[model samples]
Target: MTITRGRFGHYKLLKNTKRLSPHVPDIHVYSESVLTSLLNNLQPLFIRPLLGPELIRIIKSGETYNLVVNDNEPIVTDRKSIVPCLIKQLHPKKTYIIQVNPTISYTPCRTFYTLQRKREGANWKTVHKTVQDTECTPRYMNFLIHWKLNRFLLAVAGKLGDAFVGCHTMVLEIGYAEGAFFLYDTILHERNSKWSQYQSFIRSRTIRPFMPHTDLCTKSTLKAFLRNYGKAIIKPAVGQQGKGIVKITIMPSGDFEVQKRNNLSTYKTFDALFQSIHSLHLSREDYIIQYYIALGIVDGCPFDVRVITQFDEEYGWIATGKLVKVAAPGYFITNRAQKLLAVEEVLSVPDSHIEQVCINGSIALSAQLNNLSIIGFDIGVEEGGKVWVIEANHVPSIAMFHNFGNNEMHTKITQFIGKRRRSLSENRKEEG
Candidate 1:
């Protein structure tokens, strides 16, 4: 493998790598024609500088493009004027490239991280670093270990080190999108502290069996799902707090009933139902169509279990906490729970079984991704006592444990995070 100098060089190297070629998104040097063509083809595309971390996103909507710059509000621009808007927003005399955004049904809540490793005597050890992203600023927070992905990354790092023998360290920007991993940029001769967020899709091949049937929402997909299951849950691909979730059920009269929160609307035909959902939710952001699980109900309200699992190098995966969140009155989403109870009280499944399933799912994710230390599993227990993983939260809320009277698990999570922080500090001292 050859050491790639700039973004283009990195792309070329990644393209040539046998293991990484298929994951690479279509990219091109910036030109007005290229931009026009990409805007025509890809829904949301990235335009980034060749050398810096600054980025621009152009998303197509109706007849205009929503031009966004790095987490900012999108400014609407027409097709002919998008290049000029980029010129005004970007710095002069810098080269930029356009990349197709590769995310489909990305998780709503996720933490950003950077992985760093040092090579010595044919072995590589991670230089543990933790970065906490805040509302206004992004800084290094944590080091997560994905055993298999780590090995592959380190192999690439070793090749880079061999190619640039004199260069001590290089920072590579790797991303996961649509199930495969891609290396998009590399910073050499210096440490690039720029923060890049990577999206982790839980529907990786290994973890799919434990999850319910899920697919990106489209007319055909939604129709197929509804046809097969007679019901579907349409949720934002990137959302939290149980927001923007709509349930559509096929009535006995062959009508579609769309329910959002407390309100319900009826449509006569599948096309009418699809059109209503598309305008109300799908057109704004990405959404997924899922087979609606009829969760076990407590006093007529459906409830789901939240199981917290953490990874430990010494003892393997640990299931730290379990609690049942019953949906509020008139609302099916459990985020606004009317009551929380112990898991064993509500469901027939054994505690041991739920713990094993959650831990196994966590491990399976780690095999495919450089995943987080902690993952939260939203599990639905059916009336028949079957368990289905509804969703996996990468940044699962920890404070909720206290509300469920699980102080022991909350403290354990706090200690676990503190230990990681201390390890990160020790690694930094050694590097210094």
Candidate 2:
């Protein structure tokens, strides 16, 4: 793709590809007067109810009225009587508009609109929102179908790109929450890469094999993971709000215990722990068991840092935001459901290292993800200065940051989008 800048905007021009030829219709020009004459000639009796009173008056008064046609003919016999005719003439390969809601509608081929509903009293109002050509329709059924089909086609195209262009990239998520993997895969495919890029990168770094819940039957792999890290956390692969997480730790005296929400606790031995994991009966496909990283504590509470990476028009791979999440008292997770703390309050170590670790982690993650334009990295530093990655989330929650009254994250995101828009406008100019 060749990106060019001009007065209009940034536009991409395909190189070395045959330009599509325009196909002219046999009847190319239908004069407005001719169309009006045709409508005028229609019988009033046949058209009256069809056009509706408001539309009929407009047509009689020589005002513009919309028309709807099928097979080159108006569908309603009484054209004048029809309500303001929103005439959409269909051609062999012409685009059409389908209104899904008051606020949002979509053109047949170009865009999809996603609309949100706001409830006021007993009525609902729709809010039209446009997302980068990807979300153009408000119909859930159509949206899902489009997404699946697009993903499949993108995957095939990505394979072709890999073979020809060899432009491969990795995807990393720091917080693997429910929607995290979905967004990661979405971005990967959108950028013409395979979801395997994410999985492969993660698996290659860990010494022991990490198994999704589905592979839990493999006792050897499970034991290896537990022994290597001395503890393991079993969590739902597609969970949010820090729900359904069990931290399994083996004490120095050889006793084992499982920690969960609401202070629920279970004591177990090695055999018992294995049984407990099996008894949960969670779909192995939807869960993951990983070695737990004992992140350093602040005031005896564990905390982690979240780093957001975004592409900069001037400086690439800039760290957009950083914040510390402190776990609630007697809890292992630092989600909102847990407690949140400031960076200074969380890290027991020197303050200088906090920024340094965050900067280093952000850079490393950005490179690992093949210089992905956007990502959120969660980093944990142990008491002994061992930094471990908990996970990588592509669309980490910015709600918490916003709630905390921090505008830095919002500003960075806005700047990133603005730069892209300006780049797009520039490219359009060169194309013209």
Candidate 3:
């Protein structure tokens, strides 16, 4: 095969083609089988055993002639040596060679925030900070193969969902799903959906709206809402990350009190609060006023519980993880701005009671979200054990489970995808 180089200065060799180049390197030995063998042999040498005899044999064999594997792809050993060799063997006008590198970086790609603890001789010292920067470049072809294999595995697992759903009792999920998963969980009653329908369903079945927060917009409506709950929270309905949330309380002396997150002081009247809120440019429709739940404190910081629901192959609707999110100092919402602590560590009240409340609240929330499929229910409990529904998140972040060393949630997700793939495949097979 003798061909001119492309604009990128690279020439690709077709199948079973012999190079007839005089003063250029022949680039035709890069095959998928060869790349797979190279990756399989190279990956296991990180611990103890180094390269095996077979790899050594492959390396020594001059059959590879002037080809060298860097990272994993085959490249011309030396442009001078290989070019001269090819030129002498087969005469060609010119040649172009493509280079590939494959190496996994030991460091993470993104700047991840982590807490570090140190011990001075024996006791622990204050946490310090660190930064890590490393680039990992995996062999492109091999990476694609691994990714496809994982996808295939997920497809196979998803087909077995029916069996799993029949056997499992509870399902906990913490991820985003568009519509299919929601339909499946709701129709099958397999997992909590985390949608408003769950709340409506629970309210219809139980005859009580769970944590019905007042919707006060006007001054008169705000006064009425305040009179009902004594303490109310003004929040944006479509808001997130705890922004635009204000806590309001009515003083016994007939004056109004207001507190804003991250603020050091409280306001005594609506005028003072409205001035602050107005400065934020909040529109009437951009905010919602609700009864505030005095979530119990953990280490002097208020915290809330997040109960995740998912559908498993063996279990229908299961509570996967119970996480206690403690708000940051002077913050109102228990989000990433807050510290993630174990439920046991953050539960300030009695263990038995807290557990019961969490279980009951989770079950109720799950049953409500069941109509939706994947859901995260945030529940707040007061010091006196008054439990209230904070909110429901349809698309909650799953990164927390990655921090906790439990990837079962990911497995379930893969399984869900697999089942859907299998179902589609079967339908196509039937149609065909």
Considering every candidate listed, which one attains the maximal lDDT? Answer: 1
TM-score against native, each model:
0.57, 0.46, 0.44
42-131: candidate 1 lDDT, tens digit per residue: 446878777655667787778988897754568998888998898787767877778875645542122222333322234433332221
Q: Model 2, 1-432: lDDT tens per residue?
A: 332221011101111112201110011122334445544432121111111011111122234342322112224334453432434222324222121111112222222111111111111111111222222222343555555434433332333233323223212111111211111111112222212222333334341122122122223434656677677777654455567777877778777767785365555576566656555523222244665777777777788877666666587556666677877788888764355555565556564544444444445444434435566657677788665556556556666666554676667766786786788789899999
Off by over 4 Å in 3: 1-202, 206-212, 251-257, 264-268, 271-284, 312-314, 348-371, 405-432
Runs of candidate 2 with Cα error greater than 4 angstroms are: 1-217, 237-240, 251-255, 267-269, 281-286, 337-339, 344-371, 421-432
Writing each residue's lDDT as its tens digit, candidate 3 over 1-432 gives 232222111112211122211111223233334333443332211100011100111121233332422122334343235434333322143322221221222311211111111111122111111111122222233555445433422322222222232211111111111211100010111222222223333344342334655432334445567767887777654555666677777778766666667664456776565555444423322344566777788777888887665544455545555677888887766774456766667565554543444345444554433333445667787887666667666566656755654666556654654764676688899999
Against the true structure, whose TM-score is highest?
1
Error of 3 at 176 (Å): 42
Instruction: Find the 10 residues in a row with the least total lDDT in model 2.
Output: 20-29
Q: Global lDDT of each model?
A: 0.67, 0.42, 0.42
The per-residue C-alpha lDDT of model 2 at residue 29 equals 21
